[model samples]
Target chain A: MERLILRVTTKLLFAPIILFALYVQFHGDYGPGGGFQAGVIFAVAFILHAFCYGLDETKKAVPQKALTVAMVIGLLFYVGTGVATMLLGANLLGYDSIDPDSTHHAGQHYGILLVEWGVGMCVASTMMTIFYHFTGREPDINQEDW
Target chain B: MSAFEVELTPIVFLDLSLLTMLILVAFAMLRSRHLFAVVMLSGIYSLLSAAFFVSLDAVDVAFTEAAVGAGVSTVLMLAGMLLTARREKPKTPGRAPVALAVVFVTGAALAYATIDMPAFGDPDAPANSYVGQQYVDETPNDIAVPNIVTAVLASYRGFDTMGETMVIFTAGVAVMLLLGLGSARGGREVSDAEPEDGEAK
Candidate 1:
């Protein structure tokens, strides 16, 4: 795509989309958005890039191996947090154990934030990986034939 | 004249209009032969449903529906369509009737079930009287989060959310395994060879 307009616009919109996704990821604690939506939004920015530039370019930027690893990392992060809390002397997935020295409020807040981050990471990577697989399929037939 | 009636009136109208539009879209999508049109209509349907969610004050749900249903799902459908036929293959003779019967029966059953549900905004409803009330009332002091929904989802029900995340991860892996990874080289070279520039509208 040699079109100057699309190339420039995609470049301009790319950063802001990721930034907004991060904001939605963190601000979900107080607002209407959360990890799931934020993750999809983040993936959409990359999908837009794929639309504008090309699938191969997008894949280069976000490799399949990396996405798969990130997906596992997110799940592990969530499970690890729970296990850590358990080891700290509370029930599984208990936030109160995260800060045993004081009240549970602060622990709950931090635990929620960490858990949301894990959700966000898993969701974003999964969405992108799915998109990549779908778009990367072999073109067995001509576009016009369909 | 009552405050409750005033609040309910607009919501009733909104729900009716949104449902009407949703039905119309569904009918159009069903009748359409072109897969592209079907996908676009589905996206529109999703957006309209998201609007309905917003009206119900479930902004988190609205956001997810808009992003996942309207945005990502549409693109995925389009990509899938590229691999297959643009026009839907003709349905079998008896399939439509069976599907219609199934849909009608399911819809009827669901509507009938709604009759036993507590009225909207009923404070005494079992749903409200259970953990829902506790989550709402205690979220501020317990979690210090302004968004009770987030507190419930991430902290109160963290185990459930972790399972959901794992489910999604499994889905991604499943898709990857079913479809072998394609070429790593970007499509830029192919596009450069063609005279036509592929610019997204």
Candidate 2:
């Protein structure tokens, strides 16, 4: 747990993983990666931090309030985008009404980006929350028994 | 040789290789007594299956499988394992045969059902017709996305993905409700004195 290599590696890898997750989230229209994968990748960075530094430390970095907020806001954002389009006189989630500009294509682009961001946020937070729950538990026995 | 034949040969070979590795990993997973080994084998099986998806040109699916299957799920499984016993109980002989028979019958039935399906990469296949053709042709004009899959998933099938996002949200809420996520309000306290597993119920 006190190894310098793992500690340094996790610290170094965290930012890059988040950056890649963002890239995947935004670039889904052009590539193989998307929100779900990006979200998991983002969660992996946090999980790696937990593994190297311990759960309590990670929990301190990402508190309970923030985790819950992230999870809720992500879904809300996705649904909110859809509702905004509905308010603009299009069907629910129809991207055409999202932009005031004449071209619907640009609206679609922006709409997809927003939704993917929502997905990425939800997934990353959910994964991290699950990891927190699993690691948060106190083992019935000693750590070495496993 | 024709272009199709040249491409098909290597893909078929790769598929067979990946499938072989998949089977081997599944067997190893079944045979392993150590739970850690089983988890690792399952991760390997996911990687092999992801490779198979790649050979089929389902890059998005392969990306998901590699990330969620081999990456997140494996870590979650290990974390779950840490909360429980490391070694599985030996299967009783009485229950083993019935399980094997059930598995065998199910596998045989599924394999038989595959016979009615169209051949792989058949352009005229039902899956490649109608909706699939429409998505491919219409996505560029309608959504203007380079990746049709993204266009369809994010726009054409937006409602479905909204449902999926909700499902994930529900899962997070459920985990919080069950395990408390190290929170004290409307959840169990995380102090050392309380029984950890008891909080779940």
Candidate 3:
């Protein structure tokens, strides 16, 4: 009964934070918020949930291995955007040179979106990855405690 | 120039407010006893610094500050605290006094140097001439980004971003190695056990 109560309360507190993060992510272009702030807010929400519901439960939601993979994938996505621009006969990160047809305006939008998604992924996953490192069980500690 | 012609109303007030917040937060961070409180205060300090940057019209810098300084740095510091105790050790006077004195003198010297510097946001400053103008003007055509800072950072300064990414990757690797995470395969065992009787402080 106590565990159920804790779980319910944790979910209640975390829901608003998640919603705010999404708001920040989508509203970044026009306001003071951006991908990085949104990513941090998202990570903080997860970290709070982890603290309340135990690291094991948190891991079930976002596994450590999965987070590691996400981090790498995020970085690759960022770099790959640049590489794609290069392949399209543009200088490094030269979005204008990417699409020769439509004055490259569309390409710029596409490139920014891809890069922002990459940054958001990296920031969020890396934050969670660091949290996992600290909260994860330590074999040495168990031995010492026992 | 007539004294009446030089207006210093809102800008001066805003600058002073920013400076006050920065000083107060820095002092609070220094004097806080709880590690968590100190970490949170540091984040507040970073936010204040970001605001200052924005007021100075360095939007790109302000964005980076809000992101890396307030966001990533706070997370990293909190993670570090989790690996150790939350209480700060009492200060000792042995070598700390000398270190504090050195820091104070260096800070004073830097402040003195800035006293003769151009007022904030001076239009005729050298920074407004060489690269800043180019970045602001050509960003739309050169990089095709509406945000000049984004264009400057990702395209014009691509090499620096690559280096920064590598640094982050290196720090991640170092943490993993230090925590002995390289070869550990088994899942972490969840501990619901309460603190021991004597361990509770």
Candidate 4:
């Protein structure tokens, strides 16, 4: 865990991986990726960090509070969008009133982006939460076993 | 040309090649006695299937499989395998034939069912006959997102995707309940002296 190579490589790769995850998330409307893929990719970056650094250090960096909040907020954001549409006198998740204009795609492009964002946030953090739980009990792994 | 001769399209050749690779990886996974080798082979199988998904024009699914399947699940499996035995013990020899017979019959039944299903992209197919037609025709004017899959998943069927997100949320909650993370930040868990596995296990 204290090796120079892994630390350096992880440091180099972490930012780019996060950046790519964001690209996959936001660009989902026009391209192949969406929340699920982006979320996993995002979690993988931090998991890579955990691999290089200790889990305790990774937890300190991300903090348990932020992770749980993100996990909760993601679902809330998705449901909130539907509730907003309903409040606007449209059906649940209907795109028409979201934009309030006849043209401009009924705000669907933005709608997709927001929903995907919620999904990405939830997925990424939930995956991290799972990782934390499963590997929280992993201090027993010897340095050689790794 | 002989009547038996068949020329496959390039896409078909790619799909067949990927399927062959998938089968080989699956067999390798099954036959491998080492748990580590089996986990690694499963990752390879996932990557092969991701490629197969791309060949079928499902890039989103391919991305998901490559990330969650080949990447995340592989790491998770390795972590899980560390807690268990390193090698798989052989089962009783007598059950092998019966197991093989059951597998063969199940596989045959599944294949037979596929034969009665509609061919790829048949316009009159049951799937294409329903709301799929309306979505395909109106998606451009309705949602305007080029990715119809996203448009459908996030917009037209938003309720379903909300459920998916809720599923992920519930998974986090369940894991938290079982494993106990984040709830007791200040009250308990003050001891760093004890290793996690000793107490947890």
Candidate 5:
């Protein structure tokens, strides 16, 4: 009975968290919400699920190795955007110099989108990774500190 | 300027609420015995401060505070607590004297500074006449981003953003080194192996 109750409450908590994350992501351009907040909110839902259903299940849902890779990839994406701008004869992240057209509004949009995606991915993965570390069963591996 | 003149503005009420919430959260944080409760109250304080910043037209600061201060700091502190004690140590005589001296000096300095400062949101203040106007007027042409904060962070003040990113990266690296990547897994295994001798009681 307790397990059933936990499952139902977990579902209830998850629904609003997911909805709010999506709202934050889309409304970032016009309002207070943004990629970072959206990412954290999304991760919080999953972390709550891990608390309710146990860390093993959460690990299966989001493997730690994959999260590390996601973090690196997200940061690379952000830096790559800046590098691309430099390659196109612009100063670092100077969107206006991207194309022959003096006013590269489209380039600016694309650059911002890439950076925002990177920020979102890094934020989400790092949060989940922290949750995993805190909640997961420790392995038998010995370290210098121990 | 008539005697019967009345003014109604929601901003006045919101400012009062904001101030009240901030003070309440600050009090709760200081009074709480549980470290976790104090951290939660601090997060609430950060959110309230962000709201106040937004009301004062410092939207960029509000965004950063809401994200880094409230969200990220709370999560990191909670993670830190998992590796440490949940309750604060009992107060000591040594700490009381040092804390009181620090508070007295800081409060006096702050009071002195406030006397010379412009009123909140003063239109004629140097802050209003200086970079704020430039940001408002030239930002559209300079960065082409609709949100001035985003433009400033990503372009006008790109170096600072880069520094911030490096700081975050350093924090991640430091945590990984200090805790060691395998500590979490190891801790769990020991917990799992513990005997269930007290189950019946």
Candidate 6:
């Protein structure tokens, strides 16, 4: 796991992985990607880091508290959009009133974007949280057991 | 001959080949005794299915299958295997006949059930005819999104997506509760999980 080749490859690949995840997240509107796919892809970059550099190193970079907060924030972001729309006199998640006088298209676009971003945030952190917890466990079997 | 013929178009050939490979991988997974190999085979299964989904023109589902199913799940399973035995424990053969019978009955029942369903992608099929058509027709004007799936998922059915997000959040929380996030190095949970030597007694 500590081979020089693996370490160098991970370092080179990490930023691009995150960049691709972001592309899948925002570019989803015009394409086949979406929040769920983007979130999982984003989580993957961190998982790759943990795989090469060891779990402790990755944890130091992304604190468990930060992931927890991110998980909550993403959910709240989605709900907050709905609340804002509601207060704006639109029904829950109803985007018509978001752009009252003009064409309702812009309203729908913005509403979809807002909610999708929230979903992406929640999914990414939740996945990272799962990966962290799973890998943090003490091994039950020794090398000889394998 | 006419009744037995299926036009072997390139798309049909590609589909048959993919399905054959998928079935082969599944059989390999079933026969493998090594847990690690089985996990790797399962990842292969996911990748094959992702390819199949792309062939079916469901790119978003293919993306998810490739990412979560093949990538993260494989890593997670390997981590899980680290906590358990590398080799699968020998299963007792006493129930093999009953299990085989049950599987055969279930497969036959499912195959029979599909006989009454409309042909694949039929224009008049209930699913293709109703709200699905409306969504496709009205998305440009109503939701104003190019990707109808995105428009429908994020807006037309926003509540459902919120619920799905909450479900993912809940799963993360449940994992944290069961296996606290290694915060303080799982100081208390580690003690609780210590190997019990005399539990059988």
Best-fitting candidate, measured by lDDT?
2
lDDT of each: 0.86, 0.88, 0.71, 0.86, 0.71, 0.87
lDDT of 6 by residue, B1-201 (tens): 012334557877788899999999999999888999999999999999999999978888898899989998999899888888789877776667888999999999999999777766466777787998999899888887788889889999999999999999999999888878447354455545655787752
How far is B191's C-alpha from truth in model 6 (Å)?
10
DockQ values, each candidate: 0.57, 0.67, 0.28, 0.57, 0.28, 0.68
User: If both were scored by TM-score, which would come out higher, candidate 1 or candidate 2?
Assistant: 2
Model 4, residue B9: displacement in angstroms? 1.4
Better of 3 and 4 by TM-score: 4
Candidate 2 ranges beyond 4 A from true positions = A141-146, B1-8, B94-101, B181-201
What is model 4's interface RMSD?
3.2
Give TM-score values for chain A, per-prediction: 0.91, 0.91, 0.80, 0.90, 0.80, 0.92
Off by more than 4 A, model 6 = A141-146, B1-7, B181-201
Error of 6 at A89 (Å): 1.0
Model 1 alpha-carbon miss at residue A106, Å: 1.4
Candidate 5 local lDDT, residue B187: 31
Per-residue lDDT for A1-146 in model 1, tens only? 48779989999999999999999999998898888888899999999999999988987898887888889898888888899898988988898778756664778877877887888899999998888888888769775665
lDDT per residue, candidate 1, B14-123, as tens digits?
A: 88899999999999998998999999999999999999999888999999999999999999999998888789877765557888999999999999999777777666
Error of 3 at B138 (Å): 1.4
Best by DockQ: 6
TM agreement with the true structure for every prediction? 0.86, 0.90, 0.77, 0.87, 0.78, 0.90
Q: Candidate 4, residues B1-201: lDDT per residue as tens digits? A: 112323477888888899999999988887889999999999999999999999888898998999999999998888777666688888656557888999999999999999677765456777777888889888898888888999889988899999999998999888878867445364366556756775764
Task: Please provide, for model 4 over A18-79, each residue's C-alpha lDDT reduced to its tens digit, 9 standing for 90 to 100.
Answer: 99999999999889999999999999999999998988899999976799899888988888
In candidate 4, stretches whose alpha carbon ends up further than 4 angstroms from where it belongs are A138-146, B1-7, B96-98, B119-130, B181-201
What's candidate 4's DockQ score? 0.57
Candidate 6 reaches a DockQ of: 0.68
Off by over 4 Å in 5: A1-6, A12-23, A99-104, A137-146, B1-10, B57-72, B93-99, B181-201
lDDT of 2 by residue, A79-130 (tens): 9999999999999999878775756488998899999999999999999988
Query: How much is the lDDT of residue A60 in candidate 4?
Result: 90
lDDT of 3 by residue, A2-66 (tens): 57877787788798988887776655433455456677778888887876777788889987778
